[model samples]
Target: MSQAADRLALGRIGESVRREDATPKVTGEFAYGSDLSAPGMLWGRTLRSPHAHARIVAVDVAAAVALPGVHAVLLHGDVPGAKAYGLEFPDQPVLAGDRVRYYGEPVAIVAADGPERARRAVAAIRVEYELLEPVVDPARATEQPPLHPDRPTMRHGYREDPRPNVIRHLVIRHGDPDVVGDVSVTGVYELAGQDQAFLGPESGLAVPDGEGGVDVYVATQWLHVDRAQVAPCLGLEPEQVRIHLAGVGGAFGGREDLSMQIHAAMLALYTGRPVRMVYDREESFVGHVHRHPARLEYEHRATREGKLVCVRARIVLDGGAYASSSTAVIANSTAFAVGPYRVDNALLDGTVVYTNNPPSGAMRGFGAPQVCFAAEAQMDRLAAALGIDPVELRLLNALAPGDRLPTGQLLTGSLPTAEVIRRAAALPVPAPEPLPRDPLRLPGGAGNTTHGDGIRRGVGFAVGFKNICFSEGFDDSCAARVVLRADGRAEIHCAAADVGQGSASVILQVARTELGTDDVVLAPATTASVGSAGSTSASRMTWMAAGAVRDACREALAERERTGGADVDVEHVFRHPQTLPLDPETGQVTGARAHVALAVAAMRVVVEVDVDLGLARVVWVGVAQDVGKAINPRSVEGQIEGGIAQGLGHALMEELVVRDGRILNASFTDYLIPTALDMPPVTIDLVEEPEPDAPYGVKGVGEPPTVVSTAAVTSALRDATGLLLARVPVRPEDVALGSR
Candidate 1:
């Protein structure tokens, strides 16, 4: 083979190639956004509200402005442009002007010469507030006073609902709503708010260009969206504000909403000097939006043969103070309420309400995990009532190609629901250990909490699916520019955030595979360099980026051939098939589809529980996922394992304890996440069924594991204790007290 051919074979698609930043990240040489700095840069800090709901009586920043080394102190009146900005709705104030809706809402900002000086200046600022009762309960939100009385009606997709404190309300009616089956089960499940808990906190550096323009280097999921939201608040043209993607630690949808980007830029522009802002661990918890806490009530009906007949569900999600992506999140929750089962008659209602709780937005699993827990639990109950195996019941009702979902959108993509179910069920179960085993293998590892005296073993299975890309008529597209130099090296430019999910490596691999050469490099992601690649949430980056890069590479190659192989530069915009918004009344798609594609996964978990002590330990987990294709097998496996760890955390011990809209556990010391020792042995099986419309037939691999594993773990717990276990992060008190 020629030298070029050898190089082409080095890191082609489907190979387990190493990540480009793996060594730097592991060696602590990586520079995250929090490491950003500049000469003579001032530190920025925010003064937050201590009350969940209160009316601002007066603002007093005179002391803060007079403090030594304080460069600038800004209030809401100082905002030159728009006062509010959000991902979906412009409701959240950049700085609270009149009323504070949630605890920790930014009330003022300060920039000083040092971190300590900034903190001292922020402490000097004082604002008088008139305390008001907060609306903290989602169930009673509609009955309370309107949070935004000026905008009593909120629009979701093509529909609008005129309800107080409601962000979005959607209803899905399909087939006959009165249909009933021989066997039925009903259950109510609840899930607490979960934090993204990314290692790097919200940080950014902003520098003034001395030309009424500013450059912002920040950790975020979408650069274009950030620029779009930031420019208006600064009273500058969109082109005047340039957003450069800084090194991100992790963003499982946490960075999708604005954190410190606007505040840092505002301070820098106001002071006419560079400004750097970094949040500590406690502030980081309150800075970013968390996953929506949900209340799901589901009823599943089946015939004597265990085939799903109908599903009726009511899902209420607490969207918190502002509408980040609550409209879309509620749509996802309502659309996929029945899990991956085939149900002919369905009636679903999903409502996301504004409350005094912390704002909730995107997470790893979007809105699917909350409903999956309830749907799967109901499935198990139906199986028990009908005397059928759990896995067998799921396989019988698994969604097949050409089947219609509850939204009436046909499943045309590669959805191997049954394939994954069977594969997961076929995996070998872990061998049972004898009593009085090693202390480290007990329920509470290294804690010596149990001696295996009251241990009970159990196994459980669950399946779930979610939409791949932005749905409900959102125009989703990605643009890439590829330049092939005369020296036979190529450079690919695309504004797709890596977000620690390894999309940078996937882009490089796709460029190499399509160009048939390994001499490719990725340019830094920035708003000035490339067009929108959309947000990194919704598990769409791999599919969107691969398509954009492949098209751009092929176009560059064609241009080079036409120019006698001198040099070529080309850009291409790749878009999926257009989807339509759901009908307001019927909740059915007006066009052929309402979603771009679908991905499904299944998992089986083995758990050992101590009934007396109310503790549980997951021994093994088996996962089977439909990946369409693995652009990089190693990265895919890593994503699956990481997602499972998060799911396990939510299932067993992760919750942001909030009382009366005040977060109790705002730091890692109180809020728990899964460590290496807490993770079980996860066996992953990739079902590569190439999607017809996707480039290389690759489906997203991040969300499915998270969507199903939580339900599977909870199922195992129920089996062990013979309890309903309708809530997540099952507390020891609940288990020991036998309370649902």
Candidate 2:
């Protein structure tokens, strides 16, 4: 085939090739980590502290060790090497040491021949706890005793304050500090902690490699990071710990932190046999970190004509017992506190405080969703005061390519904020469904509690933007190797985790597109073979993986041309354009290179409120997103749909109920998620303006949809009820009763 013909053949980049795992996933034939098994494998179970805050008087594992089927029982004292491991900070104890700071803290592990035996051994272990007052309130967490008295300085030296509970305090002061507008709206908003609630519970299989090494098969976001953190704890070198990606059912940032990785390895090594650990539904809730429940006090000042003048915000996130990624979360919250609107003057202070609540870390939308709720609500309020349409109000102040952020970083990527908002707002609204609305269509759905009395409809609009990759000077890079096979197929190998995000497919697409070949093979993701692709979080997998694959394929193609069709292999570590660290005190970025790229999304939500019942039903959601480029339009749309679903869940029903630092509802029966019946129809408008700096001009597509959808849904609820709904997971009580 001629080069010109090959170029015209649409190899794969834009085509929505069927996801390789879709059939097996749908048919229940795909093997996840939980499905893994091995001969003579021991089952591991953890003994958790019942008390939220307590001094560990004693941990007697004697009885557990003596159990009939128990192969080994371990305590903090039994750890052969490092006793603590964390995502960003090595502050959390692998096994509770002298005290337990939060409920469900792992205290002991039991390895036995069977799960039942493991459970029995775990029950046999005795622990005596002296209950202590739990520091449940994030507002006062800093005033309480330090969760980590010897907490070390953060990796980048961002926190040198020596404060006990405050992980990081980032302040953004841009333009005039004290600028009050003629019209202003001030409100305090609260967001409940949300669970990633991924379908596959945290599970993994760890096998002793017989030579003082461990091989782990697990579902995780970043295998290399897991190995880096797990290796030292296991008293082994980094190369001694190998991780292979087990099929992940779903990981919306839930699998970023270490769960059973080290524990499974320790058990396997101790028992001299392979070991498997799986968290049940209830344990899964406590085993992993949650979305930081936030309290945001926001004051938006605008000109009488609905132009944004300034935004002042204080965002406090409940770090919850450990600093998984709280520092980064706080930075994101502070950076995007003002949402997508352009404001000349802004003052923002964001803090993540350590509390004895469930550990809070990464979730879909990261920290942006919480602030987006507050900022967008403020936009609506400001519009009401100015007597202007909300959409028009956002358009008047929508950020463009040259607008500066509160953090002093200038927007240089494909923002297209105004275009997104305009396109979403222009989409035709669907007519309300006919009356005698299926009892299934009512707020209570099949419950039939509502007779459609006092039903009112409302519409709300919101727009939000988030930095694409790791920011604030984190060295982020991905490595990929492309092999041009003699069989006329291109093979791509990268440690980038698929994580059910179609990243593997995206890699294949990029390889086929760059090499102009219809066939491409994806090597399994493993840390033992390839270099680090960094964490799959931050919606950076597609961008990083595709860029690396494209670059490596380009190099391999050149070699193949030189060798005249002989097999060629090339590896490339694709680095994103450099980003500088922010000024710690001022939270300001000086250079134009603070973020790899940026993506914006606009959403319009339609909701109906049953005023008497206080139940709300989302009618439809229309969204326009600046994806930069659609490498695979189907996958991009799927991402938007999935993100919107999670966002809708957060806006209406998803909350991890915590009381006095203990999760009250950990079971799925109690913790509600959206069902298919609850999902509203979504209409999406694709804004494919290419990002000049991104791979194939593609930007991160997974997170922006979620960033704005939550705000839009809740805004609609506020509009329908005519009430200032200042919190999320908006309860029926907030909108029900004698109509607001």
Highest-scoring model, lDDT: 1
Pick by TM-score: which candidate is best?
A: 1
Please give the TM-score that candidate 1 achieves against the real structure: 0.98
Candidate 1 local lDDT, 211-242, one digit each (tens): 99999999999999999999999999999999
Per-model TM-score on C-alpha atoms = 0.98, 0.97
Per-structure clash totals for the candidates: 0, 1
Off by over 4 Å in 2: 1-11, 153-155, 563-565, 737-740
Cα distance off (Å), candidate 2, residue 212 = 1.1
Q: How much lDDT does each candidate structure score?
A: 0.91, 0.87
The Cα RMSD in angstroms, rounded to one decimal, for candidate 2 relative to the true structure is 3.6
Off by over 4 Å in 1: 1-10, 152-158
The alpha-carbon RMSD values of the candidates against the true structure, listed in the order shown, are 3.1, 3.6
| C-alpha-based local distance difference test score of model 1 | 0.91
